[model samples]
Target: MIRLGHGYDIHRLDSRENAGQPIVIAGVRFDGSPGHAPDFELGCVAHSDGDVIYHSVVDAILGALTMPDIGCLFPDNDPRLRGADSSIFMEEAYKRMVARDYRIGNCDVTLICQKPKVNVENDAGESVKQLMRENLSRLLHTPIECLNVKARTHEKVDSVGECRAIECHVVLTLERTA
Candidate 1:
């Protein structure tokens, strides 16, 4: 059996936290400057690392299994979860998938943000996308060929387009292994 699931997530970009600290997305860091330069000035504000891409992927897997969402499984109010790694969420979702005898067939992700262009043209954009793909492949235990990552701007229409927030959408295909 093959099942398709969709996931979406968005987080506000805090202008305050952009000071030198790097914001993690898909386990990769995006900072305003290299080496945590104090001049760095843009990052997402959230309880976790605020990696919308990873969060969306986890949601996709949980949706595929008809399980609770990430917020339910890992509440923001939990102190222990403060600044937690998003990969942990992905791992839990993957475990659930395996328990159900399901494996990932493919996954495609679209990230929307105006400030950080995710193309190779930008210094850090393309590399970050590739890091995400590699990390996701490892997390899902799937071949790199089965995963896809794309980034875009919202054309200045909404929060993401305005560079005030970051959003991600994910589509996951799961196949029954047994």
Candidate 2:
């Protein structure tokens, strides 16, 4: 049997937390500097590294397999998860799926943000794809081609439109291989 799951997430911009650091979305880091800050000045805040891409992906996989969410498995209330690396979370989710004899068919992600330039050349989608593919491949014991990632801009109209925040949506398909 096969199941499909979709997940989405958004985080507000924090100039204080990420004042001079590069904005990392979906594991891809965007260079942020004065007059050249990757096109957006805002970022998300959380107990962990705040990688929306990884978080959404984790939720999508868990939801597809009727498993616990990232927070439920790695609660924010736990000090061990503070400033935690998202890759670990992804690995753990994949492990849970494996324990249940489920295999990942494919995963897709869309990132929506307003600034730091919407152009692909500056948005860092490729980097994100590479990282996700690598991590997912390791966890699922599959090839990297099974994962896809896309990014879009909100047209600078609303909160995301103004680059005040970033949003990510993830979809995953899982099959019971055993």
Candidate 3:
């Protein structure tokens, strides 16, 4: 049997007054702009590295297998998880899937933001795909071809359009291999 699942997440950028460490997105770091809003000061505030791409992907896989979410497995309330690596979430999710005898068919992700331009030239999509493929492949004991990733921008309108934050939507298809 096979199942498909989707997950989405969005986080607002930190204002200059409350700026913190730059949040890593799609494996790229966007150091909050310096100076009292000199140019840009935007970052996601979360317990982990706050990689929306990774978070969304983890949720998608768990949702498909009807497993617990990232929060449930790695709760934010736990001090050990504070500022933990986002890749750990992906690895854990993949482990869970493999334990259930499931294999990943493929995955696609879309990132919505107005700034830091996510495009092929910037290697945003490819970076995410490579990271996910590498980690998932190791955990699933399969090749990297089973995973895929992509990025997109919101044509400047709403919150994401305004570049005030970033959002990611991910979908995954899983099959029972055993």
Candidate 4:
């Protein structure tokens, strides 16, 4: 059997003063770019680590399996889940997928943000994307070639474009392994 699912998530960017924690996306922390003005100090605001990419991928897997979403499984109100790592959410979804005899066939994700360019000049951007692909493939137990990631700026149109938020969209294809 085969199934397809799509998921989307967004979080508002917070100033360092307002955000009690650092920004984490796709399990990678945003440690401020040295090239940015006086060091980059932007981050997402959320109850958890605010990894929009990871969360979206989890939702996609759950959607493919016709299961409850992250919110349903880990409510924001739950104190135990406060500051929880997003990878835990992904692992939980993976357990469900394995139990259902399903494995990821392919995954494509897009990130929408303005300020933090996906890749700066030189090999920095490419390196980041490669690292992300490797990590995501390992997390999903899928071949690196089966994962695709793209980033785009919102062109200063909305919150994302204005550098006030980050958003991610994921599409997943799952195939039964049994």
Which predicted model would earn the best TM-score? 4
- Per lDDT, the best of the predicted structures is 4
TM-score leaderboard ranking: 4, 1, 2, 3
Better of 2 and 3 by TM-score: 2
lDDT of 4 by residue, 56-123 (tens): 99999999999998899989899998889898998899889999999999999998888666554312
> What is the lDDT for 20 in model 3?
60
lDDT of 2 by residue, 1-178 (tens): 8999887777776774564334666555555432222444455566777777888988988898877777788898899887777878878877888888888788887878766443344333344346545655765576678877677889878988886777889988988879
lDDT values, one for every candidate:
0.80, 0.71, 0.70, 0.82
lDDT of 3 by residue, 14-111 (tens): 76355465656655555422211112356677777777887888899899988887778878788887777787887888888888988778777777
| Collision count of model 4 | 1
Q: Model 1, poorest ten-residue lDDT window?
A: 32-41
* Per-residue error (Å), model 1, residue 119: 1.7
List residue ranges in candidate 3 displaced over 4 A: 15-19, 31-41, 120-144
Candidate 4, which segments miss by more than 4 Å at Cα? 32-39, 121-126
Stretches off by above 4 angstroms in model 2 are 16-22, 31-42, 117-132
Model 4's alpha-carbon lDDT is 0.82
